[model samples]
Target: MADFGEILRSIGEFGLFQKVILFALCFPNAILPFQFASVFFIQSDPERHCNTDWILRADPDLSTGEQLNLTLPREEDGSFSRCRMFVPVDWNISDIREHRLNETTGCRDRWVYTNSLYEATIVTDFDLVCDQANLLEVAQTVLMAGILIGCLLFGPFAESFGRKRAAQVPVVVMVIFTATTGLCPNFYLYLASQFMVGIGYGGYRLNGVILATEWIGVSRRALGACGTQLFGAVGQIILASMIYFVRDWRLAQLLTAAPLAVVVVYIWFVPESARWLLDRGRTEEAKQLITKVAAINKRPVSDSLLEKIVVKETEKKGGIIILIQSSVLRKYFFTIILAWFSLNITYYCLSFNVGNFGLNIFLTQAMFGLTELPAHILCIWLLEALGRQVSIMSTLLIGGLLCLLILAVPQGNAAAVTALATSGRFFANWAGSICNVYVQELFPTSVRQTASGLGSIASRAGGLLAPLLNMLAMYHSSIPTIVFGSLTLISGALCILLPETRRRELPDSTDEAEANR
Candidate 1:
């Protein structure tokens, strides 16, 4: 058997062929932010009040101000009550003004939104306010649940099938269901579509990174992984721009799904993992791919060199059981799970609640998206310099501490809060991008997808919990921050146990991965 790394070197690693495939695989990452972070804009709470128009029946010429003043109750701050209106009365305007209606009731007809930042959103479209407001959170949770399910189903599927197939199927699913999400007639249908979209999202995310990483040399593996994330950051910026201009949620969603159609067509041209083919004893297929890659990269390969490619007969088929059965693998598996879970919770908590920072939503979101660009750039350097373990530990620790620091900032200091949150997001984004590369390096080829998938399940679980945790603000404003901060700190501390994988050969089997430390 020959070393695959040496074979990759001969074929011009990180050359034209690898660059094209990596770029093609990474393109979909740009769209994933539309799926993951669009919720913040699409579910935004617009300014609204009960339809006081019923009072118009009694006095048709009354001005907008007069109608609100007469028919709607005001909170202590003197804003018109969003969910309550006075009972309609038959009395004339003068009598009604003389003896104000004391009885209050929920909006009987519908809501009238005013000064809305968005032309429309799911909250407005579905009337998901007051009693139904919780449904908005449910929609996000449902999407995360779909992602979790996708990770579970696709992880093992990718392990059994091939990375190319796993990658292709999800793009189609995501495109279809994401468009369906826009066309959904009701909230239930919307939830269903979102769930399906999430499944596809999770599948494509896992496979695309693995496919790209498997194709690149170890020297450029960080580049390959972080490059995809850089595109993801660009996606976030694009999403912010899309939402700012196209405020209609349905139109924005349809537009978001449109680009993936291009991805679906182009992705089929990308090759399967040659490493995977050889590991599965498909030597002839691997040779053809290697030859093709060499030709594309303008490198020559000898038939003798190709003939040296062979599968190790000692390699065993792997599954989730392999992870559990081996103590070293088990330790890595659980630590990564916890780390992923914490990262997702902290990242999404800050991301989804971009509105609460008391700044312009569009600018704030754009700034948050911009923060990731430098964070990923820094992460590429950090992965190379500090090694994976220290990079992850330091980023998470610093990010978490920054989030906690917000608790000490005086309330109403929007600039201070925003500054702290953005800084934390910067580091959180750094840790997240590196973890994508780290997880792939930690496991062997046989169970890498499975391990990545299981880890994603934990991430989706954190995503699911993030919104629910944000709801904790209703009880105490500090609760969500404290919880998010504490989890991030704990996860950072746990990174102490992970082995540094810098400049290491990609492991091919369980024994190889165990021997990595």
Candidate 2:
């Protein structure tokens, strides 16, 4: 049998190069989801209400006019007006389109340029837009649903196939599909691409977390895991800056997809996780990889120590079910589910609703991504110094409270309200990042991927609810803020139930973790 203590110590140790590769592998796609979430700014047709069914009803005149209204918001001469109705395809005439005059109609037929009004007044005299809003919503929901399945599927695959192969494959897949999302001819094609993108995203995210944790020392695992996400913040900033330059959603998506090329180059530089190899009984292979890693890290390898650290199967057998069947782990999983859900909802809500912020959509996105740099850096600093529970709880609580306060702000100062809301988002995101790091530490290697996967799925579920919340908020003034605030607050309370893992060594199995308590 392997000396579990020695193995734990060895697994905890990592050097600078390993850290860099892990960071690079995990960083580029950080804001890919942001691209999807941020699409609300450009995708929502505020003026057109052409129903897909109506267009398909074989009504050439209605379909023709619907396409024109959808195009108007993108045209240089077209203008946006607000909508008074709350129907799914109804475009708010004042808030939906650009502020350009319809010179052709002498600015008299704003309804013609507006999607919903164009359908209602000019086309069918009723809703005619092809139910595009529902189609888009279904697309987003299905994509997230795929994320749930993909994360679960990756656990066994990452364990069975080895972390390096599992981690690298998804990067290529994500790049291809994410890029294609920009070229989608219509809603159906976009939906399919989103599903594939979600799958790749789930696999890469889980594997990256596993690889980072496996490479680092237990003393530094939280730092590595949390810091890995900082690269995501960097990714967000890159995407944001790119969006500012590109403006168009299709081009912006292409820019987001471009990072896959850099990740491919890393195939030559990055190595498989040594811990994963040892655990899977590939001692010789593990040693060979370790030698290369040690050389790159400029560290000397200790053969005897390395042999002592190789994990060997013991008489006691545990499987995936143990993750949920174990008492303490069950509690840990449930609490994290709540926190993850809360985090996903608010994070996306804040990002997606930038259209209502009154700032230019591109500028708002750029600012939102930039805010994470400070938030993540601050999280990294505080997590190490203050411990996970306190840092996470405080950040969540403060952020949730701030979100609620935004509701009381007087109307018409959209810019000021948005600025405050963004500030609240900064703090909320920092807290949420802390939670991601904290939950990973709470589980053992046997179920580490499983736990992270479940948490991610839960987070995506929260994302599933976001668009609905957004639609509601669009109609009811205080719905989004109140709901998001309440969810965050509840998550903050649930966070208190989790045991703190700060400055403690990682437990190797569910048995060890439960026993430690």
Candidate 3:
């Protein structure tokens, strides 16, 4: 019997059928960046001060400046205290002026934000400032938790069910919850909706790559993997533009999610993986789909060629257990997990903290988004020229070094800091694009989606930590960078031990996967 790759060549490798599937799968990726990185705009911390409107009653004709001066205290930096207000008194405005009220307390009537880039964010709407600031981290953490859970749930699911269901269901869930996210009246509801969105994000992200790669020929697999990231990069750039104009978190959330509704309809029309179908003893269905693909690509194949396509089925089902049973697969799994963890934490830490670079947030974010285009484009070449192992190692190593170099930058040098961080992001993005293809290639087809999902779980765990690590900046500004950079370097060095998968056919069984070394 011929292997699936041989069958793919006989039908059409990068023909109309594969192109349609790739577009169907990759188009949603454009929306993913909005779901993944929207927090940067939605949770932005703007300048604020305590609301001291009680003083307005004291002097009805007082100017805005006079009201703030009388009602709020100044910080040591000479700025009005954001969370403190002078204790209100019934004394006349003249007496209040005489006393120059020194007594202060926490904001009694909420806070008033000024010079805000966003008209309203979760931070402003929920008053997530001062003592409540930690909630923003909590919200992001909740989203990450949902993503982790999705990975854990969907990894085995794709193996058990078809990849088509795994891909389609997530889009439906994302559309519902993302739209719901905009309607959330409180922080708690918003967190719930975001969690569901994260779940959808986690599942779709894993399945989309698996489905696309499984259908394409070995020669085009790099394009299948890296091309989706190109769309994701486009999504980020579009997100920056949307946030720049809309300036409202709810409206932006609604707009970003709108495209996925169309995806929900079209995704159902895309066919399931022929490889997956054959593995599950649905040979007739696989044969029919293969025939359909051949027809669409205008590459007619003989009936005998279709009949010869078969998958070697194992009595032992594929799952996490199979991974633990094979020592070689275990090594690949753990090493890739660490690599994924390092990449995600470093990438997201820089992403979520785009504002801290001291550059304009929109411009900085746009530049950051723009970096992914060339990164993925270069990744296609690097994967082909340097091979997967070298590409992963080199990008991670260089990205880490650039992150560490930020420590040498002077305190107020925004230009230098932004430059280094953006450069690090460029390499990190390249490493990320390679890792996406490399992880899929490292495991066998029976457990490919499962392994990818497991790897994503580690990635999401890293993402979960990113916000908490950003919290460490309070202890010291350099702490997060130190941790991100060190882990990245270690991950890069560890990739040296992994077997290269470039130019090799994907492993179809455990024995084939173990034999790659």
lDDT of 2 at 57: 28
Q: Show where candidate 2 strays beyond 4 Å.
A: 1-14, 30-34, 37-40, 46-131, 314-320
Could you give candidate 1's per-residue lDDT for residues 1-517 as a string of tens digits? Answer: 6778899888887999899898899889988989864478854566889987777778899998998999999999989899999998888888998999999999988898888778888888888998888888898889888888888888888877899999999999999998999998898999999999999998888888999989999899999999888999889898889888888889988897889999989998889999988878888999999999999999999988977886567466667889999999999999888888988898888888888898887888889889999988888888998899999999999999999999999879998999899888888888889889999999988888888989988888998899999988989999999998999999999888889999888898898899988
Q: Write the per-residue lDDT of candidate 2 for residues 42-78, one digit (tens) a residue.
A: 4344454222232222334445555445333333444
Per-candidate TM-score against the hidden true structure: 0.95, 0.80, 0.96
lDDT of 1: 0.88
lDDT order of candidates, top first = 3, 1, 2
Weakest 10 consecutive residues of candidate 3 by summed lDDT: 309-318
> Best candidate, TM-score-wise?
3
Deviation (Å) of 248 in candidate 3: 0.8
Model 1 residue 341 CA deviation in Å: 1.1
Cα RMSD, each candidate: 2.0, 8.5, 1.8
lDDT (Cα atoms) of all candidates against the true structure: 0.88, 0.65, 0.88
